[model samples]
Target: MEAAGCSYQFRIALLGDAGVGKTSLLRCYVTGAQGAAEPDPEPTVGVEFYSRALQLPAGLRVKLQLWDTAGQECFRCITRSFYRNMVGVLLVFDVTNRESFEHIQAWHQEVVSTQGPDKVVFLLVGHKCDLSTRCVSSQEAEELAASLGMGFMETSAKSNCNVDLAFNTVTSAIEQALQQGDI
Candidate 1:
């Protein structure tokens, strides 16, 4: 169902390598509960969706259509098709997995090449922040985020830390960019 009074709808996608916690983050944000009912979520197939109505403090109401895309290489073809109309993308990576972090650039390039003129906003996210052993440091992620010309956030969907802030920050950025004709 559509949000009763939403004036805007933003289509956002979570892009990253497999097992980077995209679905967990989506579930946690939309359901306001733990990231998953099971401890280990079977990776998303092609693309899954979740929706939530957001009420910004500025009185802007929006319906967020969140897409959880499969990060496995085999499903890349399937996921790429959904990027066309996306207004924002959360480039996620598991902090404990260096390969996933390294793959972010390719994922980002795909979005840049596939989605044109829509001026989609991008955010680099370091997921699984609750884990103590991280192969990707905050400094490293920050620098990458800066180089990408986007914001960076570290969130733990499992612990519900910074999850809301991450989504809110990107959503608000998209809204601002749209209002200013930047996107």
Candidate 2:
């Protein structure tokens, strides 16, 4: 669906294990970009939708339909149902949580199995860079991203670091892929 004055609208989702900071990251990106007050992180029940209008440096205006998916196993069916229209996925993992990082491939498999690798653009996001108890190193994350053929980024919703960049880069990649008739 097109929004007034928006050039394009893409449905993007954030997926990972529970407590991986997907909701917090989406909240920070939307509110921070809008100049609104940043709120504390909260657990998502099922799925939540947030919209942000972004103007890319390349002059395309995009309205991102950000879907903050519940990472719990119980919500798998609910989240899976929304995958049809999705154009991008932010495969987020908490840097402090080893299991979340380890499960990155499974998360990617789930998405690609549902959407197909060519249908969607992906970005691996290692979140919670503000935390001192880092379990996943930047190099490890970068290496995994390289192996998966997707870009990697580290973000901290608490400190408001790289939240917008993560989303923008993924959107731009999707835009480019779409332009090249890859998606």
Candidate 3:
């Protein structure tokens, strides 16, 4: 919905398996800081929110609410509750871990079942692209995005590779959706 002073606020959620660099991506995009290389970082207990204002193509100022959810099973109920309000969902997967990439489908299905198909903009992001030991190839990610009708990109929170592009891409999609009254 539109915020005060000609600004539109869009709520976006980051979803994936645990330890998939979701927090790192958020910190990189929102705070412009390189996230620490720590494992687990204590599983996200509930939903965490961060806001950033981005100027869109048509001179529209959009405020993005990046919601980072706990990937653990126990918090599924809490995370699921926020799904209805999300205008965009970034299905992030760790490039170094094959299982996280494989789980993208399940996460997509969950989003669809809970939030419906038309209201949510879906993006597939492969995190940790700077890691030399990549487990999931670009071809696989492209194919999955094509099969699911979503956009795909690789990002490195450490190197800041495609990190801004990924977030900007989703925000642009959300802006288009809002302009067309899809959200």
Candidate 4:
């Protein structure tokens, strides 16, 4: 349900390779508890949704609708269909997995081609950052994000680090676009 006085609505999607912590991040953010009775997560079959109402400091309340998509290649056909109405995207990759990071470009291209390049704001996310052996560095992720004209952030759903900041950064960008008539 929307907050009592919310005036704006935003739809965002999480996209990445399978096992990149998309669902973990979503659960952590929406529930505010990482492991309380958390069940073993099976691979997402297609798409799942979660939403929260956020009241920004500027007094602009936004209901954020989050779409969490299946990352396996077989499910891309289903996930791509949901990309049409997204105003923002979280392009996530596992910091411990270099292959996932390598596929970021293809994922970005799919979303941009489906939603129109300038229509949605993209945020490159390096997930699973709490792991000790990281294959993808922050510098590398930052460089890629910059080259794509997007913002980059690292988050660890397991530890709940930077999760709120990542989501807030995307929402703030969306709100800014809305205020500027860009969305």
**Local distance difference test scores for all models:** 0.92, 0.89, 0.88, 0.92
TM-score of every candidate: 0.96, 0.93, 0.92, 0.95
lDDT per residue, candidate 4, 1-183, as tens digits?
466688987999999999998998998999887643676478889999999999987889999999999999999889999999899999999999999999999999998888788889899999988899999899999999999999999998877899999999999999988889888
Instruction: Report how far off residue 99 is in candidate 2 (Å).
Output: 0.3
lDDT, candidate 1, 63-141, per-residue tens: 9999999999999999999998899999999999999999999999999999863589999999999999989999999
Off by over 4 Å in 4: 35-40
Q: Which residue pairs clash within candidate 3?
A: none
Please identify which of the two predictions, 1 or 3, would achieve the higher lDDT against the true structure.
1
Residue 128, candidate 1: Cα error in Å is 0.7
What lDDT does model 4 reach?
0.92
Residue 2, candidate 3: how far off, in angstroms?
14
State how far residue 32 of model 2 sits from its true place (Å).
0.4
For residue 61, what is the lDDT in candidate 3? 82
Weakest ten-residue segment in model 2 by summed lDDT: 33-42
Give candidate 2 misplaced runs (Cα > 4 Å): 33-40
